[model samples]
Target: MIIPAPPAPSTPWPLPRIKLHIEDLDHEGAAIFQGAVNARDALHLAVQASYRWLYTVDNPPPKVTQILLILRSMPGVAHTIGTGRDGMEKEIHFSLEYIVHSKARATAEIMGVLVHETVHCYQHNGKNTCPGGLIEGIADYVRLREGYGPPHWKRRGEGAQWDAGYETTGYFLAWIEDTYGAGTVSKLNHCMKNKSYHKRHFKDLTKCSVKKLWNAYCCLLKDDDGAKVLEILSARDDDD
Candidate 1:
């Protein structure tokens, strides 16, 4: 059966208030970031991309009132934190050093990181019971869907477990969406919104256990040639 497409919004969702904070202007990475993209536009695009892929007009999540983009010297690429008494405010702390290191692809990399991190601000976490890998997988799924996935990403049938996160699980989720239906991933996200996550959510959505699905996906990779996997991986919503 063909999966129905997600409902499209007649109008764009109202965006959150966006703010920028740079910890060190003199940092070379900061300079690269400033030279690469406009902070407001980048953040706006990232948020919009998250909304476009993960939500529909009929069932949007609660509005994030404010998003503070914080650029600083950090060990990792970026992460998001919730602020405010009600946790309606979010802060995205990005590493300036990583930005400099990825200077050649700074614009796309920065936008990709923003899109990935922005997802954490809005995605439901199964009442905080969801595995961290699945959370990160969903985030990267949005980034991949938005067409910002880096060049180095590849599809591998082995090595790590399915929910190993990042592009690995992102690609697996993408395959599920393609084989089952268009809104499969969206449904998975929604299922986690109100209740604690169970592996059964996978069975609930796809009518198959997560382990079974993973095995099937792995078998598909091994049986098919690279070109076929590429076709499946490249599938995307034209409306997006």
Candidate 2:
């Protein structure tokens, strides 16, 4: 007779179950969605995108119990909210029409937007006091870092300010990461998890003020790309 072995104790599970809801099935966007995305794989990829860029296995993710993706006819591209019967459930709203028009870049663009919205779902907002620009910037920073920057993206030095959000501040944060070191953005995000944003944070991380960084960035753009300058002028004259 073979000896029976004792049952092993369970280990903690990782990641969360992703749920999707599609509203307005008769919409053309729904047809495009059927053509474009494999729902299961897309949500898995989105969760992976969030983890790969934002947190490590060693660092605990935000105890997210479940993520529900709601695809509906919305005014904007996508947004995320924490809606719980209690407080642990999360929902992300994606625009079906946005998906239809983005069929050309279905996989990547959808993943990008999903990742951005997911970041919002996971990242902390400094007790709801974090600047909206920085919040959006952090989302796009993860997107840009994960190589999801869209075709029209260009690093601009004259963005009025560093916290302009989206790709503008994403690029600025990228520059900070490059100039300082890896984990710079991570630390910044982590810092925001506890305390609100202050200008001193930039100085503490990059050893330069944000204003100084913005000034340096604007100076770099003053040197024009000769080819682009001529192309713009030519295009303007053609319109005239």
Candidate 3:
């Protein structure tokens, strides 16, 4: 007897082909991954998170023909790279050793890393001129949106610069979205499409320089008041 599973819910965004490669199936990390999450579903969720956070329906995302997830015995966490000339094909190299080490929170950490790496597969890099911190922050922003942020992640801003990356920039972007309006971050991402990165883009998008934005954001974190944040952003910046 055979029974077909029900189709998954449809999304407005396109889904690329997904492939998985395990360097050592017998590794403990491999066992943890297999037991914790379904590879197909996790990867699909990761792509969906990236699309939802980084793109809009009218403004289509970059074409990603395929995403290959490779699990191997490596150090650190995971990283994604474009293998094709057009940058459509992406490979996410995830460390099995890292997985084994974080076994207690395997599923959450796995999904979080997947979302971050998948965002790299779809996010624009301002024609490769975008700052590295902002790029990593955007990836983490998507992960944060998907509720995969670990408990240890600080919700408030930190560091001397706005682009301190990871949760710092991710939370900053989130704050901008909450304050400016919906789709603010998406507009920021679109501005970088086929264009070089510059601090001016922040002013163009939010009517405030990046430095002012960061300053206001840091103040907001201290005060725990967003209404006050706008007042700081509205003031003109001569130093910008």
TM-score, model 3 to reference: 0.91
lDDT per residue (tens digit) for residues 2-96 in model 1: 23334457888888999999999999998999999999999888888777778877668668999999999989889999999988899999999
Summed over model 1, clashes come to: 0
- TM-score, predicted candidate 2 vs. hidden true structure: 0.82
- Tens-digit lDDT track of model 3 for 134-223: 998888877777788788888555456788789888988978887787778888889899899998988888778888888888887789
Candidate 1 segments exceeding 4 Å error: 1-8, 225-240
Model 3 CA lDDT for position 28: 97
Clashing pairs in 2: none
How far in Å is the alpha carbon of 29 misplaced in model 2?
Answer: 1.1
What lDDT score goes with residue 227 in model 2? 54
lDDT of 3: 0.84
lDDT of 3 at 42: 96
lDDT of each: 0.84, 0.73, 0.84
State which candidate has the highest lDDT.
3
Task: State which candidate, 1 or 3, has the greater TM-score.
Answer: 3
